[model samples]
Target: MILNFFDQFCIPNLLGVPLIILALFFPLMTWFTTNRLIQNRYSTVQSSFLIYITKQMMLPINITGHKWANTLITLMLMLMLLNTLGLLPYTFTPTTQLSMNMALAMPAWLMTVLTGLRNQPTASLGHLLPEGTPILLIPMLILIETASLLIRPIALGVRLTANLTAGHLLIQLTSTAVLALMNTMTATAMMTLVVLILLSCLEMAVALIQAYVFVLLLTLYLQENI
Candidate 1:
């Protein structure tokens, strides 16, 4: 039963062929593109929304970090699409995989850290310990700070994995219960189905929020470094 419950999260396959690669790029396929002098209504709305989000993300970043705006915006849209698309029946979510999340988080996080160290070595190292540390506490504080710095990527990956996993598990469990109860108790099953519907709605919101939070944290990390 447990394995069956988790099977949905497994990388889906068809005739021994992995579908994850297809899933990864499916979101991009749905996007509208145009080269006309004026975009159509849907294209205009999409462009405006993306621009708004890009501007908001860039607002808190330093001028030096502005160059990353396009990269960050692309990531945000990709993540948003992936998370939302995963909620569809029979679809896989790459972000729910620890390995995949780490692959995404580590490079981005490391790049920000490296950029900081390269551009402002003193400031980056200074973050290891406060300026007013006591002589005896210096080593301990540095160790703690260093450990924290090293764990940011892990934290980012785990946060995304845990939240999506929990929500998916909850939805799965509630849905199974609803189905099982329908044979014996119609009214109770109906109530459970309503709860399941609400949970699905909540999950959609969580999908978008988690994606935004992920990008927002990266932006903040970039801000600190650049």
Candidate 2:
């Protein structure tokens, strides 16, 4: 039973070919276009929103870090699309996998760390020790800080995975309950269906918010380095 519940998170395959690749590919194809002469309402709104988000994200970091603006913005959009798409029936969400999330998190985190080390080595190293540290506690404090620094990427990956996994499980359980009760208890099934609908809406919001948060945290880390 437990394994069945987690099967949803597994990389689904059809005739030995993973669907995750197609899942990612289709979304990217839809998100980009070659048209330059026309603009629709949807495209206009998307452009405006992207511009606003880009400005907000770039506000904290120095001009030196502004170069990262495009990369971060594109990443946030991809994540948002992947997350939103996952809520649909018969779709696989690549972001829900820990390996993928960690792959995204670790490289971003490492880049910021490397940037700091390259641009401001003394300041980056100094982060391990506070200015007014007690002589005896210096070693302990350094170790603790070092541990915390190394754990940032792990925390980022775990946070995204746990939130999405919990939400998906809850939705699945509620939906199963609704299906099971439809024949035996019509009224209860109707109520469960309504709850399921509301839960789906909330999950949609959570999906977008998590994507924004992932990029926002990366920007914050970049701010520290720049």
Candidate 3:
């Protein structure tokens, strides 16, 4: 039963050819492009949403960090698409994979840390130990701070994975229960179906919220560094 539950998370394959690559690419296919004088309503809405999110993320950072607006915006869009797409039946969620999340987190986190070190080494190192730390506690505090710094990417990745996994699991279990009781308990199954619908809606919100939170934290990290 445990293995069966987890099987859904595994990447699907056809004749030894992994189809997960196509799943990862599927979100990008949703976007539409046009060179006409006027854009479609859906495209216009997408552009506006991107602009709004980009402004919110960049507003807190200094001028030096403004250069990263495009990079951060693009990353957010990719995450939003990937997360939303995963909610579709039979779709694989790349962000649900720890490795993929870590891959996204590590480079972005490292870039911020490196930027801080490159621009102000002393200031960056100063972050390792507080100015008012007691002499005796200095070593311990430095070690703790260093560990915390190194753990940022891991935390980022794990937070995303855990949230999505929990939601997916709950949805699956509820769905299975509804299906199992459908024939035996018509009234109960109808109620369960309604609950499943609500849960699915909630999951949709979570999908978008998690993506936004992930990118927002990254922006905060960048803000501290820049």
> Candidate 3, residue 75: CA error in Å?
1.0
Please give the TM-score that candidate 3 achieves against the real structure. Answer: 0.91
Q: Which stretches of candidate 3 lie over 4 Å from their true place?
A: 1-3, 14-37
lDDT of 1 by residue, 104-125 (tens): 9999999999999999999999
Pull out the clashing pairs in model 3: none
Error at 7, model 2, angstroms: 1.7
lDDT of 3 by residue, 1-226 (tens): 4437766677777777767666665545654335445788977897899889888888888899899999888888788777766676556677889999999999989998999888888988999999999899999999999999999999999999998888888888998899999999989999999999999999889988888888888888887776
Ordered list by lDDT, greatest first: 1, 2, 3
Model 2 earns a TM-score of 0.92
Cα lDDT listed for each candidate = 0.88, 0.87, 0.84
